[model samples]
Target: MDSIPVDFQWLGGAAFAIAIAVLAAWSKVFGKKEGPPAPKVQEFYASGQLADMGPVKELVESVGLVMQQMVRTNIALEETSKGIHHLVQAYEKHLAEEQRDREIAEEVARQLKDKR
Candidate 1:
């Protein structure tokens, strides 16, 4: 009689199946619930708001443009004020020169009248 080698593959598969069934039963009895996040995770996320605001890129560009315009306007205002100040100074100098000329003419007329 020729001896055939025993195949233990079937026994191994049956044992693996039983072990998996036991684990499934244990998990159903004692494991955490399957659907939602844990309470701790939910609580941690509760303080955060989801930003559904439209288009971040456009928002940034608009804000940047506003700031740039404000800066340019400020600079223009400063330059305009400087120009006004220069004009005021020139007007004052012109007034002073006109007053001095009037005084000199008055003195010359007085001297001529005294000589006559």
Candidate 2:
């Protein structure tokens, strides 16, 4: 195998240097021309309208709160129903006791009248 010719080696080095120079100049002139700077983190939080969700988020949050309140109210109503059932049972027991007492009194009175 023959060694590379000296002239060809020089030409190759020149071509590589020229390619590097052209690429650097092209990038300086046209590659991604600088636009406005990006917003800093704090500035993004402070200034952008997108960060402020206005009434839409509030409405959603209020709806969530209302749903929770409705659930609570339903639970309270269920408890109230249970309490009313207990009260009704208590009243029924009292009425049954009173009815038994009246029957006993009537039986005693009838027996007393027969003896007289």
Candidate 3:
């Protein structure tokens, strides 16, 4: 195996260190700083105004209204589905009755032809 030159390795390491330092310095100068935000609860309490607070009650009420409407719509949909099922059942019964009546009429016609 060929041995790598030591001087080239040292020069490469130095260049890497310089690049890391430059990046660190640039980030410190221009990067956005992160910290805890101002306390909204403290601001609202200190302001001594009820209107400044978050609308927790209003949000709850709106959610309740939405749930109520959803329940009502679901019930209406279920009733409509049941009505369609009943209509289909009635139509099937009517067809059966009509078929039976036609069979009876055919039997009477055959008896009349035998008499003639």
TM-score of 3: 0.50
Candidate 2, residue 50: how far the Cα is off, in Å:
2.9
Model 1 gets an lDDT of 0.86
Best candidate (score: TM-score): 2
TM-score per candidate, chains pooled: 0.53, 0.55, 0.50
What are the RMSDs of all candidates, in order? 15.3, 10.8, 7.0
Candidate 1 per-residue C-alpha lDDT over 3-111 given as tens digits, one digit per residue, 9 for 90 to 100: 4336877777889999999999999898866797666644423656334434666799999999999999999999999999999999999999999999999999999
- Local error of candidate 3 at residue 28 (angstroms): 28
Please give me the total number of clashing residue pairs in predicted model 1: 0
Candidate 1, residue 77: how far the Cα is off, in Å? 0.8
Q: Which ten residues in a row have the lowest lDDT in candidate 1?
A: 44-53
Error of 3 at 82 (Å): 1.5
Give the better candidate number (2 or 3) by lDDT: 2
Checking candidate 2 for backbone clashes, the offending pairs are none
Candidate 1 structure, TM-score to reference: 0.53
